[model samples]
Target: MISLKSPRNSAQSNVSPPVKLLGSALIALTVFMLLAPLVAVIPLSFSSEKWFTYPMPGFSLRWYESLFASDQWRGAIANSFIVGTAVTIIATPLGTMAALAISRPETKGRNLLLLLFLSPMVVPVVVTALGFYLFFARFGLANSYTGLIIAHTVIAAPFVVITMLAAFSRFDFRLMRAAASLGASKMTAFRIVMMPLILPSLMASAILAFITSFDEVVIAIFIAGPDQRTIPRQMFTGMREEISPTIIAASVVVIAVVFALMATAELLRRRAAAGLKG
Candidate 1:
């Protein structure tokens, strides 16, 4: 018996070792660049020194303890959760509905509508924050939770819309029609037939929207009053007014939360893909 290798395989095998090593080196460099700041910040959060300095004299949990003990930090954390929850609640449904509508073959001006939905993502945050500040002020929403929620929703909704759009791209509309033929109402059909298929995507979008609102700072600064200060806004103020290890601790907590959310989203995404395949 004679063994023969395909030309394509032979060509690929002929690639130089230096090229593979170069590609690996580039990838490692990119990962290091992205993670270097996080690496620095996490250790600094545990440092005992009042100021942010290298070669720490000791490590202590005082900053983390202070974060929990301080009224300002507690209030900011509460406000962040409140606003993030509000934004997710509002944005998720609206985004899913918009995606469903746009996914329909007969929907008119779909491109225009999609562009409008995604405009917030393209526009500069400072510009959007300034606009929200002026608009909310006139409506007596400024310096209120309502104002922050609305502003965050405006920005966060685009993430949900984009995510749902991708999910809807793979959705089978025929199942929805099948449910309708069985005497199900539109809402009932969606809940029973469509929702299960897209639920993971919806959950992921909500998480992303929540993170967007939670981490948002420019809009929070523009619209949030002292009483409505969010964690990011509070951190900004602390950084400007005074330097403390507490901000470092807060950064570590935030980074941890973000990593957890991202991991959850990735799991949901994998499960969604597996479900679709099955």
Candidate 2:
């Protein structure tokens, strides 16, 4: 039998060496450009010198010690986790529900609703901050954790929705129908069949929502009170007022903790996949 593959298609599928080298070079350059600042910052965070200087005198964890020792910084760290957790809790379910409804083939006004849900992600943070500030001030929520959590949830929900929608796109709806045909209620079908299949995506979305809220400073500045200061807000204030090594140390601490958590999660996911395969 003659091969069905066309020469042009084969040529396109097998990229030229020069093109591949160029693409690899571009990718490496992009990665370096993105990570250079972080690489610089991470080292500086461990510098023994009081001020930022290249070729530091020695390494020290004094900044980290100072950060943990400070009442304000410690409180800010706690507040960050509180707001992030609350935002993740509120946004995850809401986003999942919205995604489920919008992903349905029979859903009406899906595009419009999706746009509405995603408007926060599309709009500028400053614009969202201003709107939240005005709206929150009217209700005496301008300087509260409640306002901060609510504001963060508005922005973070879009990530959850996007992640969930992507998972839903890959999911087979037939399993849901089959469960329903077997006399399972919609809720039962979701819990038994859909949830297990999409649980990884659900976890990912929650993590994204938490990260979004934790990293958000513009909205926190507009909404959070002095008492409810978050890590990002505190970092912003530190940058404006004092460029202390503690700020860099805080960055390192946050980066390390989050990275470790995500790495562990990935390991667990891989193990689960391997076990299932086994």
Candidate 3:
């Protein structure tokens, strides 16, 4: 090793070991915390015993089989998908428009507008649920699919707005003007130039919003009826009624699906960033 007499080099060399140690510790702690519960759940799901007993009670996939066999579980999953998709369809376009408007250089009161857009995220879910219950009851929408969809959209829209705003902040708006000058119409410029640039961010936002609606329980409970029952709402009721390994199995499946979607979104983001740089 070569010794560096420069003060900056000396300071960096002295700091490196401690920084590495701290980073390693943080990574290890995070991994353990995330994986520990998952491991517990997996074993519980496979346990041959009826109850949640640790130790070696043998293992089987009976809980998973039961989960698949149950019509209520299947219906709940379908309901979640319907709710998630509906919320995505509503939130993505509106959020993207809001993000575009707020990101404009000449936009006035942008901070206030952003606050308004993000208020749903800042406010407690229970508060939103309560407010929606009261409002929808007056409108005779309570316990209807429309009410559930609207409630989920309200909660999910802020996530899309925030994600798109982060993506839009680094964009070059002059590109659209250049496209227009190059014989592209206003719509063509937006379609070809802006859409490609923001596509990954939009996808990420949509996926996040979908997952938010999928896992949401508070608003679902307030607005959803038997016909509109979602996976999270069913899971909450099931959890309150009894503790079953089937619940853990269902949770594992949902977690795995969400993890896969998020992983795909992250990969797309990385590719988008690399393409933008190159």
Q: Could you tell me the TM-score of candidate 2?
A: 0.91
The best candidate in terms of lDDT = 1
Instruction: Compose the digit string of candidate 1's lDDT tens values, residues 1-278.
Output: 86598888888799899997998999999999999998887898888888778888898999999999999999999999999999999999998888877888899998888898999999999999999999888989999999899889989988989888888888778888899999999999988888898889889999999999999999999999999999999999999999898998887888888889989988887777666666
Model 1 lowest lDDT segment of ten: 269-278
Off by over 4 Å in 2: 1-12, 261-278
Sequence-dependent TM-score of model 3: 0.91
Error of 2 at 86 (Å): 0.4
Q: What local distance difference test score does each model get?
A: 0.90, 0.88, 0.87
lDDT of 3: 0.87
How far residue 38's Cα lies from its native spot in candidate 2, in Å, is: 1.5
Clashes of each: 0, 0, 0
Question: For candidate 2, lDDT tens digit of each residue in 6-79?
Answer: 99888877998899899999999999999899998888888899989999899898998999999999999999
Superposed by TM-score, candidate 1 places the C-alpha of residue 86 at a distance from the truth, in angstroms, of 0.7
